[model samples]
Target: MKTSLKSAKRLFVALIFVALGSCSIAHSGDGHSLKVTASAYNSVKSQAHGNPSIGAWGDHLKPGMKVIAVSRDLIKMGLKHNTRVKIDGLPGTYLVKDKMGKRWSRKIDIYMGTDVKAARRWGKRTVIIRW
Candidate 1:
């Protein structure tokens, strides 16, 4: 009876591990995806208040860093600070380091690091994002 109870306990532990592993795997690559209006912004006095290089989450914005500012509505939708984002038509990933004003909704602003021209060139378009 003791051996059988031990074996059953071991089996239950193994099953719990399997269940947890599958849960992580399902969320790893298959995270939440959303379609949002994407635009670009530059780190300049006219664009950012106080310190232009400082993000809303207090992350420093340097040139060539892949970071984005999400709208307030998107924040409520799981795009919280420091969230990793996979943007369609863009390489690698971007981090959500800042946030837009309350007026903005369902939008994301790509950081261009003081390059106003580049920001303007990016313009605005609808793009899919995954996290």
Candidate 2:
């Protein structure tokens, strides 16, 4: 009976470790991971000045594109133009095709095209991004 109880305890500990490990993997991913503020934006005149569909790096943005605008500070951290990134809690990969203003730091703006409601729904939150 004592041997059975010990085995059960060991199994429980192993399961707990596995659960913890999986949680970290989901957030940290396989490559470099960073925690930053995430928001959503629309390609509109009110939101984007001058040419709304043109990115800071001269990339043309269109509707239904999976792209993000990274803060200026993130460029120094290897998140340069055209970099692919994986955002936690979001499916698929997002390309870094735009750039935020200098006032923002450690933040990313998800491009939502003309979906103003979706951008508003996204709001602002802290998220982990992998590159």
Give candidate 1's error at residue 10 in angstroms. Answer: 43
Q: Candidate 2, TM-score vs. the true structure? A: 0.77
Q: Any runs in candidate 1 off by more than 4 Å, and if so which?
A: 1-29
lDDT of each: 0.89, 0.91
lDDT of 1: 0.89
Candidate no. 1 TM-score = 0.76
Q: What tens digits encode model 1's per-residue C-alpha lDDT throughout 1-131?
A: 99999999999999999987654212445787877899999889898789999999899999899999999988987889999999999999999999998899889999999889999999999998899
By lDDT, the best candidate is 2
Best by TM-score: 2
Residue lDDT tens for model 2, 100-120: 999999899999999999999
Q: For model 2, give the 10-residue run with minimal summed lDDT.
A: 22-31
- Model 2 global lDDT (CA atoms, 0 to 1): 0.91
Give the CA lDDT, 0 to 100, for residue 113 in model 1: 91
